[model samples]
Structure formats: C-alpha cells, structure tokens
Target: SLSLRPANSGKVCSKGAFNSCAECIVSGPNCAWCKKLNFTKTGEQEAVRCDTQENLKTRGCSETEIISPKNIQQATQKKPLTRFGSFVDKTVLPFTNTNKEKLKWPCQDQNVQCQPPFGYKHVLSLTSEHQKFNDMVSKQFISGNLDSPEGGLDAMMQVSACEGRIGWGNSTRLLVLATDDGFHMAGDGKLAAILDPNDEKCHLDRENLYTKSNLLDYPSVGQLAMMLDKSNIQPIFAVTENVKSELQKMIPKSAVGVLSGNSDNVVKLIKDAYSSLSSSVIVTHDTLPDTLSVAYKSNCPGGDKPGEEGICDKVGIGQEVTFYVQVTAKECIKPVSFNVGPRGFTEKMRVTVTTRCECECDDPPMKDNPHCNGKGQVKCGTCRYDCEEGYLGQRCKCSAGQRDEEQLRRECRKDNGTECEGRGDCVCGVCQCHETEGGKTYYGTHCECDDEHCHKYKSLLCGGNGRCRCGKCECNPEYEGNACHCKKSNEQCKTGQTVCNGRGTCQCDQCQCSRGYKEPMCLTCPGCTVPCQKFGNCIECLAFAEGPFQKNCSQACPTTKVKVVDRLTLSTEAKKCEVKDSKNCWMDFTMEELQGFDNYSVEVLREQRCPEPPNIVAIVAGSVAGVALIGLLILLIIKALIYIKDAKEWKNFQNEKKKSKWTNADNPLFKEATTTVANPTFSGE
Candidate 1:
C-alpha cells in the first residue's frame, strides 16, 4: 500500500533565473522564461516567468514548454539509521535475542553465546570471534606498524583460518568483516605476512611483522563475497561512512553499516545487521554430493524478479510460508545427508535423499541354495539356476515322463538314441523325415506313405488310368500298365489310320511328330512360306530380262527418244540387274515357280521440274516492321497511363489546396487588404 508521488507534474520546462534561454534552462529544471517581443524588462510589461504547466498556460505564452527527460530522475527512498543508544526498534522486530545482557561479552568467554534455538550458533560465535579478533588486532599493533591498511588480504586470511572449524551443526554460519579502508588481496598484503604467493601460508606471529604494513593490496569486494559464500558464510561489513558505500557496492544493503570510531558503535551495528538479516525469509542449501542436484520454489511476501530463483521474501512472525523443493539425481546412488535452513541462522533441518535403481530381492540362501541343488548363483540381487538334463525351473525337478522311472529314457531325436524311427532327422522333441532323391516326401510323423509321387501325364498321375505307390506307377490292365506307357486302341494317337501321318510313332496316347511337320501331324512345311508376292519368282524374270529386250519401247511410244527403267525384287536369291537406262526397252517372259514368290506387276514413272529457293530479304523486312509496330503500341500505352495518373494527382492537389484554411488569403493577418473609412472624425473635432 506504499505510494511515492513524483515531484514534477509531467511538464518539460519551467521558470528561468537567467537571461539566455539555454543558460536559464540548463541552470535548473525549475527555471522557465517567456520570449515574447520586448518583454525582457522586469517592470509591469515584462513577460511572466512560468515554472509549472498551469502558470505557463495562464500567461497565454506563444512558445510551448520544453520537457527534458534527462533532467528528470526517480526519487529514491533512504533508510534511516538506528538511534545511537539502542539499535533495536519497532521497525525491526526482534526474532532473535537482542537483549543487552545476552550480547555483553560476545565471543569473549565460552559462556557468552547466542541464546538457544538460534539459527546460526557458529555464525553468532564467529561474529563474536571476529569482534574478539578485531579487539586483539587493535591492541597488538600500533598505528605505524599497520602498513597494509587498505587491503583486507590479512582479514581474508583470517577468514581462511576459521574455515572448516566453523561448524554448521544445528545452526547457520555467519562471517562479519569490519574495516575502515579498501580490502587488500593475497598478493597485495605485506610480504612478511604472506608466507608464499604461490602457496599462501601466513606467518601472523613472526617474519618482520612491523614491515607487514603497506606491503599488501586490498582484494576486490566481489572476490571476498564469493569466497565467503563458498564456505556457507554470510559476510557483514561494518565500516566508517567513508568506505561504507564502497562496501555496499559489494555486499547487500542490509549487510553494510556505518561504523563509528573507537569501536563504540560496533556492537550496535552487529545487532542491527543480525536482526535485519535473520528476520527476512531466505533459502539455504546443505553441502550436496556430486550425484545430486536441488532446486527451490518460494511463495513468500514480495514478488520475485525475472532470473531471481531461490530467493525468498520477507515474512512476519508466525506467518506460515511454503517453499516447494525438488531434489534430483544424476544416476543411481545411495542415500546422502544434507541440511536446509535460512542462510544466516544456526537452526537447520536435516533430511536424506535416497535413490531406488536396484531391486532388493529376497536374501540369498545362507547355508546352501536349494535351487539347482545348491548350484545357483547370486548377481545384482537375483538368483540364477542352471538345471541339468530332465529337470526344469529354479528348483530343478524331474520332468513329467521321467518321474515314474528309475533311469532316464531317451526321446526320438538325432542327438538321442532313437533317431526319428530311423526314417528322418529329429528336431526338438519330435521326428522329421529326410526327403527321397525322387522328391517323394514322407508323412505320418515318420517316413510312412507316398501315394502322390510318380511320373505324370497331362498333369494327371499315371495318365489318370492308374495309381501311384512309393513313387512308382501301377496302371490298370486296359492301359498296358508299364509306367502307363501304352494306351487302348481307341486312345492311340492316329492321323487317318497312320500315327503321326506315317512319319512318327505314338507314345503316351499322343503323337511325337517327325521332321518337316508340327507336333501331332506331319502336314506343314516351314520352307514353303511366301515372301514378297509382288515379285513372282524374281530370279527367272531377272535372267530373261538380262539376255536381251526383244523390242524397244519406241514401238509403243510416239517419241523415238524415250527412257526405259526396269526394276525387280528377287525372293529366292540376292541379285539385282545392273541395267539403269534403256532406249525404249521392252521384254516379255514367264516366271518360274521359285519358292516364296506369288506374282509380280510393272509400272513406269516420269521425272518433274525442280523447286525454287526461299526469299530471305522479304522475310527480314516483314519481321523488322512487325517488331517496330509492337514497340510503338507498348510505348503509347505507357504514355497514356502516365498522363492519366498525373491528371488525377493534379486534380487531388487542387482540391486539397482549396480545402485548406492555412493559405495567406484565408489567414486575414497574413493577407494584404485595404479598408477606407469615409467621413471619419477630424483630429481636432
């Protein structure tokens, strides 16, 4: 329900304190001035100086206010320091012990410890120890002997000195570092204080302790915070006002406080810091093994920012807040112990995370394993038993057939003694027969009957006149019975009383025809097939024409100078006539009955005139003219489109110019006009 109202009312410029506009505005954001004509005088006619939006609008100023964002800044709320006397106040309620008596001798005596139920006992103890150590440091050395005043490397070394020794136990761990100047790192500390740079080992009691002053440099704030956080130690910085802001840059605002001189306010600072830190809700993780990971979800008071995971918000006393925690593992691992608590407190809750990747079966037999006659083995929490012959299962007992007998009986198998009734190969617990050479397969769970195997005719076993037994043919008497080779007289192959047309014999009731005939008959001659029928017995006609033409074609032609050409297609032989041109040649001859030729015909052909060449010049001229015409049409179309577009734009411009009221003629003040008043009063009247 908190509200922070902004100081400025969202205006750019305000009143000015100087004459120049730039100088006046730059001087301060509250400065604003009017630039009206001749209004610079401070008298009654001077322009009014405006600092806010209301004032500027009331003055009727022509110029607008300049709103400069660079001059604006969000106001920050500052925390008030606790009273010098008692650090505790109503703003920070005491969740932990803040009584004066309880913290009087902090860490000085063993009896002076944090109250019971405190979250971080070691942290409180460490805070007390830090105070004691600081007291020792103040008393042991003089101002001149403290040379490395800026660096906290020595202080960092002191933190390392308490490492591992600060126990978390049922409490949290806290580390308080009080300084007046910048902290020095390991290499920047006094040479004598640093035993070795490569291997840092400090000699606090010896090795030129006086020269240790100014020999080391301070460590960066980030480095110190990281180191402290790694050790599960929450660091608090109590420093003078000069270095308080610098330290605040490194630590949280709650962890850094102003430290007065002489250590008078140290106690109060520590109490206030502890109260603020412990009161806020926070999440802390215990040391985890390499195989485990943890994540947290917070449902506390304030809303968390993006990327700010695992950070809890503030909560009042007795306010119940829930945090969803998830723990995961990389692989199967045994149970491990880890603690969870707020970072600065001593109180913590211990819990164990266990993985279940392997099964815990019933325990292995102690004396002897009954399964497999004590031969079973244990592996990965399970028992494996390899039973012997005639036995099965983990307990290994006799099989069904062998239970009644004293000795074992072999089954029919190739590996066993029976060998598949001596007819086939044994497979598994049964018999399988070997196939015969003639492809007759046995059946009946052993080599038994083969009634389907035999020489076949027309896809029928034994020509459909007999039965097959053991791969042999047994025909009926009507079939002559020798592998069914003969048939009845009516079933014999015949062609008009002679089988195969007296050219071949009959077998299996069908004719096996001889050469020159197709199957089942000796009737067809393949060589007697006809070739080109247009040329009859072409060789004989060619021979007759080659001898001599009996007469010339002039007898039938009106012109004596005539051309005769003869053509022939030979069928039986590959020959052609060499004669090409003959003067009115003529001949007549009968064709011989040569093979593959049926008849012939004759014709005469005459030559014709030749064709003329193409006209290239005419084609080129016509193409050029057509292309020019198309280009002219396209250019005319584009020009028309552009002209129409320009005309439309011009019309729009004219309409807009008429509609606008900002022209000189419309604005009376800018336009020139004359008005004459007749018979106005004279100067003296």
Candidate 2:
C-alpha cells in the first residue's frame, strides 16, 4: 500500500510501500495487490502477502474489490478521520538548492518571475515536466508512430506515477486526459497480465507493465470514475466528439474536439479543454474541510453574488475572475489542502491552511522622534513642531528665504528676511508700493521716488493743468509750459495778448480756434451778422452776395458770420459798389445774428440798395392808384353816353310832334282818328 503523510513529516513513502495484500489493495487506487505475496510494505520484510490467490484468500482479501466514494464517505461519516497532512513549518525548511531549482524551472523560459503560490512550488516542476512529456508524445506522433492500441492511456498512468513521486503537500490533484481514440484501460492492453483473475492482483515486470499491445480489456466507465475519485484526482477528459458524451457520464466535466488522429490533435484538444474550463467554474469537492470554511467572491459571469461556493463562474475570453479564498481555521491541526480554480487548468491553486496557534510580533515600537529634532511635541505617534508662525509641511519646516509663521502666508523674503526688497509690502508673492498721497504720486519697482515732472516752474506735477500722459505733459490751452505752466503768446493775423481769444488749443504754439470762430486767432466770421454794423452801407456784401467784398466784410467787424445777395439796377454806381453796372445790380441784404451771449440766432434786415423797401412800397401804391383812375374814367364815359341818348330821344319827340302838326294840316282825318281813339278808351272806364 502507498501511505501518505503531511509534508512536514520527516519520513517519505513511494508507490511500492505496502506488502500485505489487504493493505496494498485498500491503500487508495494507486496501489494494487500482487497475488504473489512476495512484496513487503516495508522492504525489510519481503515475501509477505499476495504471492498467490490462495495466499490472498488466506488473508481474507478480495482482489476484485475497489475503493469508491461511497465507501470513503461511509468511513468518513463514522468519525472525523484525519484526511489532511500535517503542517510543515516553512521557516525551518531551508530552501535547498534542488528545491529552488525546481521552483524556478520553466518560468525562466517564459521570462516570467518564479512566483508560484507559497507552499505550492512543486506546481512549477510538475507542470514543466508534464509539458515536456506531452511535447515528446507530440513529436513522436508527428514524426514517428502513435498507432499503438493503448493510445495515450499510458501517459495518464505515468502522470499518476510522477505525482506519486513528487508529492503535492496539501494540493488537489488534476488529470487532464486527452485522446482521439477510445482509451485502453486495466485489461484492454498487454498490461492486464499484471492482475491475477482470482484476486485481481497486478503483476508487474521491472517496468511496471507488459510492453505488448492488445492484451488487456478496457475498464468500464464506473470503474474508472471510482479509481480516479479514490485517488483524489479530478479527471478532465478531452475527447473526440464521439466519445465526449460517454466520458461526460463518467467525468462530470469534459471538453469535446475534432481529432485528426495525431498527437497534435491531442495537444489541441487538451488546450481546448483547458480553455473551456477557464471560461466556466467546475468545483469538484462536495464540501470543504470542517475545521476550515471558505467564502468565495468571483467577479465573473454568474459569479457576482458573494458568499457563494468555491466555484468561479464563467468569465469572458481575456477577462479575469478573482476568487477571494478566505480561510477560517478554528483549531490548529494538520495542514489542510483544497483545490480551487477552473476545472482543467493545470495552474489551479492548492490552498494549504497553516494555523499559527500562537502569535509573535514582528514590528516593535520606536522611541526616538521620526522627523522633528527634540524641539517639538509628539502626539498620536507623529512628531509635530511648534512652527514659529507661517511655516507648513513636514516638520513645520519653512522654505529658504521665507518668513516663518507670519499669518500663515508663505511670503518670499530677502536674505535679511525683509519682504518686497524691504521697500514694499508683500501681497501674495509680489510687491506693492505707495502710489499716491494727496496730490503727489510715487513710482518705481519699490516706490522709492516721485514720478518726474517739470521742476523749472511753480507746477506741482504736469503744471497742475493737464494730467501727465505717459510721463509727457498734455498741456491746457493758454498755458504753454512743457508741463502747462507758461502763458501763451499772441501770434495771429493781428497779435494780441490772448491766444484764440482764450477759446482754443495751441499745438506747436499755434492757435486752433474754437468752433463758430476761425482764422488767425479766430478774429473773422464766415457770414455777416444781423444788421451788420461794419458793412451796413455795402448792401451786396450784407445781403450775402457772391462778391469778393462779402468774404472781406466778415473780417471788418467783431461779428461772427457774413452773407451776400445779388443786386439789380444800381441807383448809384459808386466806387464802393462791387458791381458797377446799373442793370440788375441792386439787391438786398438780410442777416442772422448770434444775438446774445447764449448765441441765439436772430434774423435782421441789413441792407438793400436796388428795389429797397420804400421803393417797393411806392411802386405798389402807384400801380393801385393807376388802376383806380382808369376805373373812374370808364364810369364817367358811361354816364355821358346815357345823357346823350336822353337828349336825342327828347329832340326826336319834338320833331315827331312837329311832323304830326304838319300831317294834321295835310291829313285832317288821321289826326281826328287819333283823338277819337283816345276818347273811346276813356268812355269804357
């Protein structure tokens, strides 16, 4: 029987440790009985049991029997059988050179640091050796032959042997079996000769198996599951699509792949199996150790809930799922191990629980100050200095050339510790100087001097008449100093003491007159004033005529403007008249004066020579009188004609009377008829 112990135990055991038939048969699945009874559990006492079926039956052992989970659970339910290993005090186990070599094995090739979890250093060596073995098979399958009926079943058995040789202290064992063809198990190959029919004993040659092919029958599925479960090896089958379903019945977790009947396909199938396992969780254990409990948290698909079982759920392709393995050990005993990780991954962690029954402190308290030199107080384990005023940071240390504890502002200072070059107050980090005091102003980086101005005259600054513009004087008018202190001089069309009548500015000492005033000290106006005094007799000029004298008339008086008007029929061709002609030369003049100091406009009649007001009035009166006289003469003529008609009518009447008298003489009857008609008309009344 192969006996197991904790890693801390000094003794070692191997595959061929048991000698008794019953002991060998019941010492887990890796051990088998040899009906020959020639082997001994202790090599010292040989030929002990299992030499033949009679010897095995004499010991009351059944060779056909096997260990299964049912029996293991039954035995465990009776009493808490110690199923774990003893704690190996890692401190005393000096890391030997050989162990270190194993620990650092293949990680060096991948340029990865050798950081296998603590106490699981054997993982690196096991995985490295497994990879090498797989690589050998792959090379042989590709470049050599792999048609043996046993397929890759021998490799699986060899891995079990390797695990037995290299003990996994508290680590769980995992076997990834990948095969394109159906597996040849206990009896399918020539290796079945090792087991006797009556006792189910394994007879081995020096190499531990028969070398020929097709001499054994494959074990049933149930038998394989029982063997693997008893050995504590979780089997992950990577098989072809045809065999995947059958293997899943035996092994709860299996991966399927299409195989090309080559070792290359085997590697691919195993890789696919590992990939599938990594994407989902497949926790194998039904329950954890009683003394220790686990709480799991996985940041993976279907693993969001906390306090779940020790299984990590599915995760995305390149995504990670973190399993927080919290161990609660109430009592210290042997080292306990549990496996947790993706199902088929070879790097699944084997967590070993090592309980420290007693506590030992590693860090001690210090007495000396950490930063401040004995000048400060220590509170809450920190050294705090009594900073003078403004300093802050570690140890209350101020920067160089800065004042300490002045209103808590880190003000920059000179070497003498004076701020702002000792000439101004510091605001923030910069300096400010006194710029004004009543009428005086200070200027400079430090306000050490007054702003410069004219010193030759009695001027406070810039003559107190104009503000200094960028250190240059913009002077007020009539005051012409470089700083507006000197009085202006007169230089105009006619010189006077006042410049521009004190109404304009002097640039380059020249007069610029104010509006409504102009030309050579603004003595001239553009138009004649109302009732123009100077040009009162010059009617054309006063009337705003377009004459040369109209412009000259503006300068003749103190008035502000001038105008002109056209004339007709000059009454007198005088020498002063601009137009000497007598025809259409007389006109008038009306002027608008700026009346008062307010300069309100007032229109005034100035001059008129041709067709002046009185002449126009007389002409209008004479035309009216002529029209009245003509109307009177026409009335007299009408009366005289009426009188002539009356006179003529009376004369004609007298003549008619005469003619009637003559007719009476000539014609008495006609006269008598006239008289008779007149008498008859009277008798009718």
Index of the highest-lDDT prediction: 1
How far does residue 232 in candidate 1 sit from its true spot (Å)? Answer: 1.7
Tell me the spans in candidate 2 whose CA falls farther than 4 Å from its real position. Answer: 1-155, 164-180, 185-219, 226-241, 260-268, 282-294, 316-319, 325-685
Model 1, TM vs. native = 0.30
Q: What is the lDDT of residue 308 in candidate 2?
A: 42
lDDT of 1 by residue, 1-685 (tens): 1112335545555433333333444555554544333221111111133344345444454443322222222323222211100011011012222344433322334543322221111112223344555564444311111222343444454343344333233244555666655443445433334333322233233221212222333344565556555555566678777667766566553377787767778778887877666667666577787798877666654433222235655555456666655678998877687876566544445556655432222235442345334444332211223344554432343344644332332344324445444656533333445544655345433344455778888788887888776567878767744457567453456656666556555666665666455665544446544222323223223433322232432233221121233543443433222222223233322222321123223222222112355588988998999899999999999999999999999999999999988634455467557877777666755
Query: What tens-digit string does per-residue lDDT give for candidate 2 at 569-669?
Result: 32221113233212344433333323222121222233434543358778889999989999999999998999999999999999998887432346545
Q: What is every candidate's alpha-carbon RMSD to the true fold?
A: 48.5, 47.6
lDDT of 2 at 191: 34
Q: Residue 45 of candidate 2: its Cα lDDT?
A: 23
lDDT of 1 at 450: 58
Candidate 2 has its poorest 10 consecutive residues by lDDT at 80-89
For each of the candidates, give the backbone clash count.
Answer: 43, 46
